[model samples]
Target: MTAVHLADLLTLGARPAAGLLLSLTDRCPLACAHCSTDSTMASAQSPGGPFRALVSSFTPDCRPELILMSGGEPLLRPALVRELTASAATAGTGAALLTGMFFARGGGRLPPAVRRAVTGLAHLAASLDAEHEREVGRAEVFRALGAALDHVPHASLHLTAVPDAAGHAYLDGVIADVRRRFGTRVPMLVGAVRPTGRAARRVPVHPPAGRGATGRGATAPCEFAHWPVVDQGGTVYACTRQSLLRGGPAPAHLVLGHAARDTWRTLSERTLGDPLLRSVRTLGPVTTRERYGPPPAADGCATRPGTPDPCGSCLALDPATADATARQFATPGGRAVEHTVLALAAARPPHRLAAARGTLPRYADLVELGWTG
Candidate 1:
């Protein structure tokens, strides 16, 4: 089939922007323990220029149907939202925001300009996990949720479920409460803790189990194979996990060409003809066998200095070991590195499925405390 035909099929049941995850900025207001972006805003200030440039590049031909603006907190850069929303609207794409809702409460309301911008978009997703609640304050989150409800009618709440009993309980309560207060209109998406960012240091990483719909249960075919990530640094990758693991190197790391400069034909040829993809198809089952082997020890970088061995649920488990393994895969004959990444992405459950499937009732059972609905 043609590439356009393949892209449409891949996104058949996916939500808006189902194929890509764009990191607008690494900066965030709250220092949540389990952030996937590993964002701290320590990088450059505003991504408006890069984002606008990307939009301009995609206009007329390659505009993505769904665009998600994520960061430390997207609302922190209100102007970026305005620009992004306008660009997406002009390009006939839907726009969404993923944030911590830090500014939603705390006497900080969504500015009228932001509200106007949001009205032009499709959806808004606010994070409300335990760490986010602690950093941004729950009362403020609720207020922010209410405020978001006021402007964006299609707003949804995301509650991250970290490993361990307490984390699970916290997520449960948050979901229940959100459902009670907002009903199904503002659905809740439960995500598992990923081993990236500061969370890699603070939260313990465990073997992927019951992490999400796919992680805990069945392994679905990856839909992200055709979708690519366009990071704020102007780099593109086949997947966000690859971008993070490779530290944003050349597109060759993920076998993707520059989205801004390369034509879709060039990108398709390179991606489909990539040795990495071939190796993955060959070695995926073998690596799957090794993944269930004895877990690594808790010493060294696996556990941050002065911190307890949170390795049980930690994503940084054996960074040295994993790096070594990755190197082996990178070896001339092994190609095991490529297989390992595919295995990880396939193993890790995606929280987006619940949101995409509109399964809010399952999440509502968790957050029962102080539920307003």
Candidate 2:
């Protein structure tokens, strides 16, 4: 199998139905304060049978091109990683994983089982940050990552960057250290800590200042709506937002289908053919809501004082509004509009796509590292 690079993930992420995100488990041994999933050793962990069934259902013609497995700590079940990646490979799908490197705490050595899991992957990414360092030293994490680079065809770092001075310095130091050690061979994807799960209070997430429901760039297509995310219980969602993964049935529009029941072909068709989803992908939630749904409320979820959240508006969509949205997209004109928006979004460069997806705009270029194109 060909190595899958960070650039490959970012580029493919921009297209609809090009990839899948499987949250293997909600359990993690670490207690990082900024944990978005609020994961811990005691967290809920579903059995792995459904996950294996879903991947096995994928045929070469119907499978997603990439399978991104993540969790509180996916490597906690190293054997599952090896099994799922092997299944994906049979269907011609490349697989990647994101782990917290908890096993590296003692001496940065990979357990025999963990080493076997890493060897079969197309890409392996480790998370590092101030919060993570409090549990596992940076040196230990790096040493483990260095060993992983040898086994996996491609490896990268997932770093968290806060907006303050301390956060900025930490990011710079880490990037430099990683460059000195691994050079440009490893790429990095830097994103701000979102206010979700346990990080909700610890991290300050302010909406873009002066941006309302119809603010500047409000109509940009939502590329994230492309990849479907499967949570621990095999429930599939259209968006990868962590908050949606919270244990409950997703809103009608966001819910795709259960992996145990739905085949890749069924989920892929819903991802592409659903009118409401198509609208969200073409014109962002804000524009979609305002154009078809009821007039926007001044205050709602994800909305702060004088600021509006497109995602918030999307989630709060009423049944009447949702129906209206579907009706609008069922028309010939609406389908044409969607096609135009997708064409423009596809023309964007990978770095720009990364930035648009809410990563720190300046640091987004790191995703293109080592890419000849």
Candidate 3:
């Protein structure tokens, strides 16, 4: 099998239903302050049987082009990692893993089990940032990454920015160091860390300017709703807010299906054919609600008061609103409008998409590193 580069993964991620995300486990050894999942060693660990069953169901014709496995830390389940990698390969799907480098904390080298876990992966990515550095030193991560390159055909780094002078400086320093150490051989994907999970209280939230209104009433298309995410317990969600889809019940609009019961084909069909989702992908959450649903209540959002929130709008959608949206998009004009918006969004390069999605505009281009195209 060939290696899948960072650019390829990001491009695939932009297209609807082109990829799949599996949260192998939520348990993480590290206590990164900015962790989006608030994952800890004490986090609930679910059985891997449901995850295996879902991947095993992917046939060559129905498999996603790529599979990205993550968690509080994915390497904790090395044996399962190896198993899923092999399974995906058999169906001609390339698989990748993202780790927090907890295995490299005491490191001179990657643990034998961890090395075995990454053996057949198409790509390997390690998370490095100010918070991660506190638990796992930069030198230890670099050594593990060096050995990782030997096992996987391609590799990259995932960095999160804090959006202040010091935060931006940390990102700049790390980017320079990675380039100096690995040169152009390694690419990177940098995204702004949101005020979610453990970072909620620590990081201040900066709402997008004119977030509810995009000047001409146009909103940035939501690429997050494109790929389906299978949570640790087998429930599948349409967006990146998998945390919301856990515990109690997931929002009806975002719930795709459960992996324990649905196949890749079923999940993909619902993703592409769901009327409410189609509207969200094209018109965005705020626009979708404005155009088809009732107006948002003044007290709709407690966290982001007086702000027009795209996600909150989507979450608060009513059944009547969903029905109205379905009716509107069933027409030829609606279809044409949807196609045009998606085409325009798809034409953008990975770097531009990164910037549009809230990565620091200056460093977004780092994702295109080592790409000839």
Candidate 4:
């Protein structure tokens, strides 16, 4: 079952930003201390009811370029993975899945169902890091990936570590090892452990520092808002920030709509065109906050010194403020700037997107690893 190269996706840059992040379940077998999705054996699992229905709604002309299935561990629901990938394939949409490799602890045998699910995939990205290494040995993961290379056309590594010296050293060694074994056959996306989900208890939230801001302290446009995330409960969000989508009633601004009630066409339209979302994507949350928000000093944001947390300001927006944002971006100059941002991003190599988003600055080059170009 040959599939598309992972580099192909990396090369897409956020241009059209036409991709979907569909979380299959919130249940994971591994207990990595740094797990972001906070997965556990007892975590909530989502059946593919709305998830399937949404994918089924895709038409060839309107479908996303790619559909990325993730999870607490997507492989746990192998049948659903197979079903959705098959559905996506019919629409000329590419599909990929990410996992922590729970089945590879010992001899690393791919379960029959998992093998079936992985067949015909565009790619499979396996997670490995200090915590994952402890939960599943490095040897086991390597062996499992070696086995996978035979069935999948493209495979890659999704690694996470503390963004410090020790973490860098660990990733360097693993990347070297993967190359020694696979000889550039696999690329890697190395990232810092996000302080969300379970890890939040131990690590505080901090977007990477040194990100630039404008003269008035507005932040870089939030590339995060460009994609839509479908959480386990079928709730769709402008981005996958766990805090943004938690529980009973979501803030109206962040909630795009539920997957059960909204089709992919509807979600895509809302995500790409919603006034608030457009502002978040074009000018970034912090900039939008300042350009249309209360004086920074009055909000206590200016008093903090340095650019305020981008997402924090974004989350603070009200309907009226969002409307103000809509009108701002609707202007000719604002629209030109927005078009320039998208054009510049699309014009550059995709690795730049990886760097801006959070792949360690040093390892971002590896994003295009093994590409013939």
Clashes of each: 17, 0, 0, 0
lDDT (10s digit) by residue, model 4, range 166-199: 8789988998898898888888888888766666
The residue pairs found clashing in candidate 4 are: none
Model 1, 156: alpha-carbon shift in Å?
Answer: 1.3
Q: Candidate 3 — worst ten consecutive residues by lDDT sum?
A: 208-217
Query: For model 3, what is the error of residue 44's alpha carbon versus the real structure, in angstroms, after optimal superposition?
Result: 1.4
Pairs with backbone N, CA or C atoms under 3 Å apart (clashes), candidate 2:
none
lDDT of each candidate versus the true structure: 0.51, 0.81, 0.81, 0.77
Q: Can you write out model 1's per-residue Cα lDDT over 152-231, one digit (the tens) per residue?
A: 64666667766567867887677667667766556555666665666667655543211111132112323334455656
Q: Mind giving the per-residue lDDT tens digits that candidate 2 earns over 37-107?
A: 88989988899987898899899888999899999799988899999999999999989999999999988
> lDDT of candidate 3 vs native?
0.81
Model 1 lowest lDDT segment of ten: 1-10
TM-score, one value per model? 0.65, 0.93, 0.93, 0.91
> Which residue runs does candidate 3 get wrong by more than 4 Å?
208-218, 244-248, 299-306
Displacement of the residue 300 alpha carbon in candidate 4, Å: 5.6
Error of 3 at 172 (Å): 1.2
